[model samples]
Target: MTITPQNADDSCLINQTVPTGVMSPPSEYLDEKKQLPNQNQNQNQNSTSHSGEDQESQKGRSRSIEDATAPLPSSSSSDRGDDNDNNDDDDDFPEGGLAAWLVVFGSFCSMVCLYGLINSVAVFESYFSTHQLAGYSSSTIGWVFSVYLFIVFFFGVQVGPIFDRHGPRLLVAVGSLLVVASQLILGLCEEYYQILLTYAVLGGIGGALLNVPAYGVIAHFFKRRRGMAVGVAATAGSVGGIVFPLFLQAVIPKLGFAWSTRIIGFILLFLSVIANLLVRSRLPPSTHPVRILPDWTLFKDLKFTLCCVGVWFMEWGIFTPLTYIVSYAAAHGQDANAAYTLLSILNAGSFFGRFLPGFLADRFGRFNVITITNALCVVTILAFWLPAGDSRALLIVFAVTFGFASGSNLGLYPVCIGQLCDARDYGRVYSTAVMIGSFGTLTALPIAGALLEIGSDERQGWLALILFAALSYAIATSCFLGARVLAVSWRVKEVY
Candidate 1:
């Protein structure tokens, strides 16, 4: 008698499709079912008293499933401990504690190195266009960041399983080494190919390794408050985004591109050390087999599948503004400081955007909060950004509001996926969805760049990108609404 992910027998998983991806105990995994009293323990013990070894094993297995949320019993526990223990801490997430907070801090530091750079990619795009790869077209230069983002998310499918099996230590260590090297080498890169290798390939892979575990470790520490915990850690991205651009502005002129990048590498080196020391998981290693290949069958659940599509569209829309805002402001005849300031303003709004919505999501429901944020994203892009031209006031307003609306996208998407899957499967399920969304990240900025190229003039090209961004968000909003309606069956008041 054995249990594996392949043989999940929960009534919710096998008997029929869970419409909301939720149900009562023994049949579903939800926040409400984290702890339960085992009503059948006495009957199971009595029935197995004189039973043969196989019967005893079978009895233990039954008790394990029926009382899955209860503490693991002494008899035959090891045989199926992985399945039970995986959910053991679903209810046990320390709402607040020193060690848990330390892990959050460590994740924050990791994100500063990972997403922090991601948020500042526009600076690199601007610099490379004017400096090292000046000969390349904007579309060609756009490939660098697009490929970088693609690697970070696409390799997430592999990183998630490895984190589940082995934890984050080795992954973070190797990732740190690679990321540090990429930054150091990037300072020396002048050719298109060298920049591609160092920034896109090397940096991207390192980012993937660090990003998943940084998030997975947080998932290990907090469940009920995961949205907020993740949101807080995610603030490091905005913080980094703000810090790096300003740092680059000051240092790039003084130290030149080479020394500025090198200094950033040193900063990442310092942060990585802190992250490695503090980040560790409380949960025991998962015994279920790791599947590097995605489980495509999960998409059969239409709600979950649509959620993935929604994220795919989200990246396409959100990244365009992030990468182009600096250039857009510059095109309006702003100085260097003014241009970078707008990007900083966006990141500043994102700082509040992550934790505030996360706090709201915990009380309001992840799906509900994210849908509102996405709608806000559509409005800000269309109403504020599309028409904001040379007017500094309008551009500043657009940057702040759009950044707020899209800030929750990163933190809450994982929270939404968590609501749809078993606690134990969060990492894998989330990474798979990200992998599918990687295609959008891979092409988004490049396509926007190409659109910029197509216009008769630079302003016309940017106008086209603005329209594309709004349309992408509009489509994404509809997909998310469809998923929510399917999950809650038109009950808009339902907390999801």
Candidate 2:
């Protein structure tokens, strides 16, 4: 007999026919008593029971087969629902697209304006100490930049939560205005306090506003590719680092400090416009009002605590070289032009170093790559920088190598922090980490400058400072290793 199965959708046709031979006896009918010879009776009863059991088992199997092959209304619908839910979750992350990359580009421009000015601090420091603040000791002059650096990170504590609530638009816009204003007004300042208020206080606040959001917004757009995205954005700072110094070197001789700064202000104005247009947040703002305060409770996480400590020491080591490299080169008898050129070279190397480690961190692990680079920084400080007294080539080599190694610290530290917390809390966590590290930045230059005064000879003073930097990196490396070990076991092959 031929039979046609019903489709699941055709539920209206409820009645169906079965072939005549397909029906089975009821259990009671099959079990009814039978008479026979004693031995034959036993065998016949066993065969009857076995036949009934076989038919029952076959029927159960056929039902299971039909259930497996045919789709049920509720189950099939629910399955589709689950798939849709998963798709919705995935759709929340754009991952990679034109809009996403535009955010990245906008971040890049913002960083160029923010960090570019930051990276060029050495130029300002060098120029100011010699010209405007010539009467002050190097240690005293260090306070201006130190204060600037301190406020930049310290303000992040408050700015981070604000970014989470309002998004990056207003923060970046205000930052752009403040930074441009700082530069434009900076050219007109002559007194120490005027310079301090204009450059240190104003610029620092602007930078804090710009810096946190530039790094934080990228977290909104990318996850797996975050390191690469951050790296690309960070390279803009190094480019600014290279360009700003060269720009100053070229124009300062002809236009003097005032007009040179104004030209830079104009350049920053243009960059800020691009940043305002493109930099945007992908995630929605928090519904509940968040306190614009640092969550000190984050210290509860040992990894975060350790990461903060590691960053503290790393920041202590990093800025000492950046702030003092030009001064150190000049003190060691290098020509004025060459001494300033060393800063450019360091930033030039940093241009590549910023992105390369970022790219590598995505493939390897963030902590792993940062730890290696931090170790290299220690080696460069002690091995190359310390012994290179008056050696132009060694100073150049140290600048380049140290720049390459230390550049990762800026780009990778945020990525490392992101690894510890949710993306939504990244701004708060990262800003807190930076706030902690700000103390290091605040004290490192002044302390290094004081150490410079301690030595009777300039060489001895520099040696003390270099050793201080080296020791800081050593501590940073240890903390990073501890954090890594806590995150993943000692197994070297683990991808963590």
Candidate 3:
């Protein structure tokens, strides 16, 4: 009846019964002792020996059921200490280094290509209205850019999940080809349908493919300093915004729209190559297939839902100015070159706005900075832009001020969303939010264009459009404030 530790695993032990006279302690008591250092070895040895007539009976009973049931002792604390060290190593991040910054540089290049074009939509709008597509209504021309913006964001719903499963290389490389091809083909389009098919559909799809991974890759190398890193990359778009308008203005006169677009296409080809080389995902791919799909259940989170709503409104108002400022300026009496300069000036202010708020968002709080900027967007539109009319100085001020205020809208949305979930799920969450926001971008511009068709004069129509944009910002600011309050209480000092 006596059981030894060496015989513990034997099948014979399973049916053995202890004697009735000797009682065994409960399993829980022995389980607790098993957690202590090497004590189970002594307890086992002691239980093996018994004296007197009861020796045989006691021996039978000492075949401890608790010892049989308990798990084997864990490895020494020194071994566990090594395990802890290994875990710490796994969590370590390369916050800033040459490789990390190179990734940032790659993202910057990609943004310049994607966002630069997005910001320069006004230049194209102005040009098409006055030249090639002059017979088309403004609302009709508006669809080309609106569709482009729509595809750029809406397509991310699929591209994001693919990036999560496959990584960024192929997506970006393919995107580079499509974007460069779009630009090259864009110069050849003489008809309205040709322009829409070439620029809006093809260019938009390319931008979507390039844009998601560009921003997504930054999150991989940065966590603590992500705001600044993302900010730096986002500035490339504004720089592109500034440079493209000026480039188009100068080249369209000299080389004509066709060759000018081809030149820009060549520049984009070079930038896309850099993006394909530099922008890479640091994290391992998700093994779960479900992870690669949009989880609509995430919208159930009230804070996230509110954040998306806020972004939707922000996007609704944002592109209205970017798309119309040149037209607005020209309509109000500014000459062609001056109107294009105004677009560049807006982007110039945005170049600073993109990075500075990002630098501060890391310290002050992403939502805090975003909320403040959103409020400022409302103020600038209502106060500065709406009343400017033909006043050249006032229009310039509005362009710069509104540019600075709204620049954070694009840069900070991803940063703010990153705060709400695990880094691995960032692609899904971010793309889903943007997909929803794309509706606003798709509708906002055309609506503004239609609004421009209203009223006795261009100024009256523009005033209505400006008021609409201001109202959208006001709602966006309120939603962001609500999200901020839901995430972190009204405690004035919290750094969330």
Top-scoring candidate (TM-score): 1
TM-scores of all candidate predictions against the true structure: 0.84, 0.82, 0.82
Structure candidate 2, residue pairs in collision: none
Superposed by TM-score, candidate 2 places the C-alpha of residue 211 at a distance from the truth, in angstroms, of 1.0
Top lDDT hit: 1
Off by over 4 Å in 2: 1-91
Please provide the root mean square deviation of candidate 2 (C-alpha atoms, Å): 18.2
For candidate 2, the lDDT comes to 0.78
Tell me the deviation in Å of residue 100 in model 3: 0.8
Please give, for residues 157-262, the per-residue lDDT of candidate 2 as tens digits. Answer: 8888888788999999999999999999999999899999999999999999998899998988876567788998899889998999888988898899999999
Error of 2 at 60 (Å): 48
Segments of candidate 1 deviating more than 4 angstroms: 1-90
